[model samples]
Target: MNSLSNQSRVTYSGTGRRKSSIARVRLIPGSGKLIINGLPGESYLQFSPNYLRISYAPLRTLGLSTEYDIHVKTKGGGLTGQADAIRLGIARALCNINPENRSTLKSEGYLTRDPRVKERRKYGLRKARKAPQYSKR
Candidate 1:
């Protein structure tokens, strides 16, 4: 049998963001595996199965779920935001491997970075838009 060292190693990387969260993702040729923040995807996101689906949607879209291994480092925001960010990051890394995939990924809306963010509170308002109780006497 041949040694594993005989194969060349290559990695693709990309960054993705949503709201206040950001994710850095790397892709390497190997059996399907996803590691996020040093934890397996299923384990880290077990609390929400939807998040697991969201994070892997890109690969599934391109029928590449089993062709590459994914590694992600994410910070900020909540689990949902982080999951979305990782999805975009993976899409981007796939695009890096083949520019032709951009159109397909874009069509699926995976390549777009979500621009929604929390609104800042106003000095006079209770929140971004909520006003204090009006009183008339």
Candidate 2:
């Protein structure tokens, strides 16, 4: 039972970003649970199946979804970006637990930080790329 004590205390952490969102994730050995910003993951994520799936995709890929609990603090961007960030963060933390997991995570593209972001609106444009209606007269 002494060995279990040491294992219980081990924690893996990672950071992930997507668009304007950032997620700091920690993986701990426990029954699968997700806590985000101190709130239950399901409620915080509005119980959306897609969001939950995205957040757990990494663990599911490794067949360890129920072996670890995920704790994350994420901010910025919309839910979509936050969910994606959580996915990446979980993947990275999994890699930290076992380097061999890196290859599988990478192959699934979960380790890639999405670079897309909102473009700054130009001074003369209505939005990032929209401009005044063209006048051919």
- Top-lDDT candidate index: 2
* Model 2 misplaced stretches (Cα beyond 4 Å): 1-8
lDDT of 2 by residue, 1-137 (tens): 99998877989999999999999999999999999999999999999999999999999999998899999999999999999999999999999999999999999999988898899998999999999999999
Q: What ranges in model 1 sit over 4 Å off? A: 1-7
Q: Compared with the true structure, what per-residue lDDT tens digits does model 1 show for residues 83-123?
A: 99999999999999999889999999999998999999999
Candidate 2 TM-score over all chains jointly: 0.91
Residue range with the least summed lDDT across 10 consecutive positions in model 2:
2-11
